[model samples]
Target chain A: MLEKTGLPTDDDLKKVIPDKERLAKGAVVIIECFQKIPCDPCAISCQFGAIKPFKDINDLPQVDFNKCTGCGICISACPGLAIFVIDNNYSENKALIKLPYEMLPLPEKGKEVYALDRAGKIVSKAKVVRVQKIKNKTNIISISVHKNMAMKVRSIKVEDKKNEG
Target chain B: MKKTNLAIIGGGPAGLSAAICAASSGAKITLIDDSLELGGQLIKQTHKFFGSKKQFAGIRGIEIAKNLLQEIKKYKNIELIGNATVTGYYEDGILTIVQGSNGDIFIKLLPDRIIVATGASENMLTFVNNDLPGVYGAGAVQTLMNLYGVVPGNNVLMVGAGNIGLIVSYQLLQAGIKVEAIVEALPRIGGYLVHASKIRRLGVPIYTSHSLKEVYGNDGVEKAVISEINKDFEFIPGTEKELKVDTVCLAVGLSPLSDLLWQAGCQMKYIAELGGYVALRDDHMKSSLDNIYIAGDVAGIEEASSAMLEGKIAGLNAAVSLGYRVDNFLELNRNLRKELEELRANPLSEKVKIGLEKALLKREVDQ
Candidate 1:
């Protein structure tokens, strides 16, 4: 995919790579998590088999960016409250992180939300730019956050979120 | 790809039953199986299964398969393709199957609909010295003795108290092999109490809360070590004991082969109770993909009778997709669902039901 798009590093997901720079050249990393329990779904949910589950099921995911193609497919595949899609290659200092949002009255297009990271830390505010309906009927809301928080924020919480009825 | 009305994979009782069901509906079927002759695991099973009349309970496995095949002979639309192994599956119902019996020739199938009935295989456990040659799967032992008429080993230590282990142990004794003991990791035997009592009557010891810790042998299993566990499943160190044995049989459990469905982009969920990754499907056995259906162990590891019902459902649904509709498939499905629920209600099938519930991951999807 990188070759056709004239990008540098492009490798199949399953094959292992050594250099970190090569891993992140044009990859679109996605981490999908559901619960607060520690998990690494982005690591194990990659179909290209690019990511590896770091240690135990509780470990945080570290993506090999070079192998990712910015595909948001894994956004919904993740069973955990982890996985998000980050595409910094497009748009200025803002990047998109597609995280899972399963609440009813699901976030509408252009709605504002809070972006949270691995430790449920609010790194930055985000806005819903796109809403995705998955095969399993779950909704994923893609949020655009500051480029700095792209790697950290893998999920979103509706502002003043109420329990899903 | 060769297009047929229906393509049934695996030739076990479930597959054959589905074939008969589909063929009865006047749809052409291509029965593809990897073995030279198609009876699947049933060919190695010499024991009779227990179930209701619909399941042909009390009938030997071999005879069940045979009777299903005889019924298939009556269906002119069904085509028998034995010795064929499905290697890969792609979109648009295209199947990449290798015909091993025909000199490794590749057979591409573009059936209007597909039913995967690939059944479960015995699960092997990892323990100290478990790689010993005398250690074998319970199914492997059954295949060896019943099919090849060969004794696996003289004195055997059964590593599980499930139906497979206990039944195979009894079969081993029938073939003149001695069963030293049946050691279970759980405090309770997982199989029917009747089966356990039968083995006990024959002087075979049933050790509950005991687990196989190690085995010793020169080149193959010859001796076994066991330790008892407390209520918490933690082994009691002082309760360790050793027994002289030649062979070890594992009937820990069975895992379904649902990889083909996974490869076909079928939605799957890991419900530990279900044994492994099971494809998500609805009441009609239809998966996320409309044209693709799952049956037998691939749906969720269960008995052949349920698999047969699932197969019938899949085949009938496929027929409906192929322009053949049943008059009252809905009513028949309702009845089938009731029967299946009852069958799964058995003590032996409770785990299987739990697994099925987990596989679906939804409680009320059974409408």
Candidate 2:
């Protein structure tokens, strides 16, 4: 019961991922919402109507990468913090991943930090590129990590505990 | 004796929204809360809420609380009294209360309509050494960390994998506290998959079909013992594992605190879905006894979004009963109910649906 639903499997992740070619072009959204819950902020947040509305309130939100300019509004709009924006064409060897970060002392731009994978384990070193604080104090942070870790890196590790507050 | 058109108990999402609505309807409203600060659980909820824009979706709970407070201030007819505890509801809608920073002052209010939204209390799990100081409820952990900015402990053992349990575990991590494990007695995690995934991605192991056997410590909880359970929920020997931790957070469930409703002589029914014996309410959220209404957790243990919708309905209905006219009242009520149904359409709320059905059936039989 805690299998695919709780921790989504690789197949579940595959179903929600956008086109590989489009993702590599930069600015594509990844929505990991698997359950049929009554939430639609992600759909409404999109100015370009990239996110499709649910026939039923419980239907999972679907994203069209073609229309999705990846304005990153949906990142902070998601209550579950499940939506993310990835730019695979950031640089020659780096890709940028923008994730919803609500923690204190937002990571400093250009500061190198430990990039973590889906399991939160340190996978690679990354540099913070941008931090955007939207409505309700939800911060959207874009970090540059190795191109290979684009999909793997989901969060940045803050080691210094004292600065958290 | 202080007089008002309506009196709302509890300063949570329900009461706050209700007060705002009733005041907007040209009703004199008096909102009372026990806490020095308002917002109930919203004050400690840093996470963004999920719902439509009407319910303030995409907004953090703290911000919603602030907006509600600001909105309430716009109406001069609405008076908010903090640091006030409602002690009793007596004859003819009279309310006995203790109001002061320390509750040293006493007063009685006579209001035409009363809305009880006292909310719910955390259900504690019974195990050896569970009474230790380190064994805290999930709400206590949130209040300590999010509200007071004090981390409960370094290493913690979470008991239950419900929404509250999972959310609190994630929050503890955000507060720099280490959650050793989340043990659930049930065969599966009871919370939403999204919430479970958030903590799982953080490397926190969630153990279903497992129960905490004992919590061992001297002055406080220093360690916890857990074991797997069989179909009958009996402990399976040789499956015991000891986890060294300083805190144990119980997030098993919550029971509605409906003592005020029960004492007010409203007909009560034991509806498990509504979280124990709660006052039976009609479609308008009015109690069996006229002039007494219920909303929020007092009606059932549901989400804050549902509570706000329920509060709006009750507030409008209470205002109407007091001869106050609200524009397009029926239309507004219908829309709120429709939104609530949409929110409860998820499979996770099936139990709540069943409970509500039973309560509605019982109410019909009485009618």
Chain A TM-score of each model, in the order shown? 0.59, 0.92
Could you tell me the C-alpha RMSD of candidate 2 in Å? Answer: 2.6
Residues B1-367, candidate 1, lDDT per residue (tens digit)?
A: 5888888988887788788877867888999888876778777765555455566654567787888878888888999887888888886568888886555688788888888888887787878999989989998898899888999999999988876777787688667678898888876676644345445534577787888888998888878998998888777989998999989899898887887888988889887777788888877787887778888877877667677778777777778778786778778768877767666654456666777765552335556
lDDT (Cα, tens digit) per residue for candidate 2, span A4-63: 226667788898888788987788899988877778898888998899876767778988
Residue B157 accuracy (lDDT) in model 1:
91
Candidate of highest DockQ? 2
Contacts from the true interface found in each model, as a fraction, amount to 0.00, 0.53
- Model 2 C-alpha lDDT per residue in residues B258-344, reported as the tens digit of each score: 999888988889998778988878888898888998999989999999999999989999999988999998999899889889999
DockQ of every model listed?
Answer: 0.01, 0.53
lDDT of 2: 0.87
DockQ, computed on Cα atoms, for candidate 1: 0.01
Q: What TM-score quantifies how close candidate 1 is to the native fold?
A: 0.66
**Residue A114, model 2: Cα distance from true site in angstroms:** 2.3
